[model samples]
Target: MPSGESGHALKVESWGDPSILVTEFPDIEDFHGQLIETVLRLEQDPEFTRHFDGHVGESKVYHVERWDCPAARLIDARAKALFTSALKKENAVVDLSWASVYRAGNYCLPHSHFRSAASLVYFLDLGDEEAGGRFLFTDPRLKICCRHEPGRMTYPVGPQVRPGILMMFPAQCVHMVTPYHGTRPRITMSWNIDDKALPGNPLPN
Candidate 1:
């Protein structure tokens, strides 16, 4: 939360897997303002549709790749710091980055990112508190339980729906979003980092 510092880390309860990390940042680097503004501007831009895809018309998967995220530089540095600190991967570079706007009825299907060591989702804006739009992740233990398990998480799904929150996990983890019925739109930015991208003293690299 200091100068040149990234966001404040939040605790992510872990299970047996040590390669897992679920960190929450408290907007320590001031990336939230820029992140939200970029999406808002894109929504009004005539060509916004051309630069992004997913949930464009009939589709519901939001993805923007032609232009890097507005806060790419800051995100890159902070993300590297966090990833290396959590996963011990250094010299990390963002291989892919994009922004998405989720309006009413928009939802993402279950999927995992490919060709990357980790995947991150930064919550730029959460439209409504009652819209019931929640981030869902598959159980890491491969459980198919429809009910809660004892001495552990009972549900097979995990949810995190909050603004100014950044969620990171293994690239191979499957996740999705529930339908957003809120009147206001939800904005978010996501990216993946390749293990091969990091190869030096992360700070100077």
Candidate 2:
């Protein structure tokens, strides 16, 4: 993919009722390498804590406010831009930012982010395409699942997973990841954001 003068190529696509924004950053090899290394190093640090909840299975996810890495900041800027463009709202701020590292047998259950106007997931390293860690979004309506035929309703549709692809959707959209079976780890970064700054959660500097 040919990049712009700034060496950053972006392509944005939006769909669905609430609108899901899928942005492709096709030229960021160096930035991705730096970010992957940074996250791996942090994982090995004894002081860096990992978080787990009922929604995740054997995966490492943690919040970070002080991660001032240039690659991360670049992602933040792009996310804010996409948010504003899609929602026609300005001064959007990231309420929470986190990184997720998933090994074999790791997955996330269907859930939605609360208190957020929107949320995004950036695919850093999707290990194996056939290893079955596809991201899925369930239809919010209960009537969709009642159909007897399988192909009739496309409720749990997902985008093609690839590196440097960022997907932003409404906060209420319930999404999840299937169990991964690849030998290599699957890595991703996420953010919970709103149109404006929240009371206690401030934007990253």
> Which candidate has the top score in TM-score?
2
Q: lDDT per residue, candidate 2, 1-205, as tens digits? A: 2233386656677644337788778666868888887777777654553645424644344455456577766776777777777678866777887778887878888878867799988899998779977888775442333254643444576777689888888877788898888888788888888977678533232
lDDT of 2: 0.72
Note the Cα lDDT for every prediction shown: 0.59, 0.72
Backbone clashes for every candidate come to 3, 0
Name model 2 segments beyond 4 Å from true.
Answer: 1-9, 15-18, 46-48, 53-65, 141-155, 200-205
Q: In candidate 1, list every pair of residues with a backbone clash.
A: 55-59, 148-154, 149-154
lDDT of 1 by residue, 24-70 (tens): 56653466677566666666655543322333211212334443565
Report the C-alpha displacement of residue 105, candidate 2, in angstroms: 0.6
Candidate 1 stretches greater than 4 Å from native: 1-19, 43-72, 139-156, 197-205
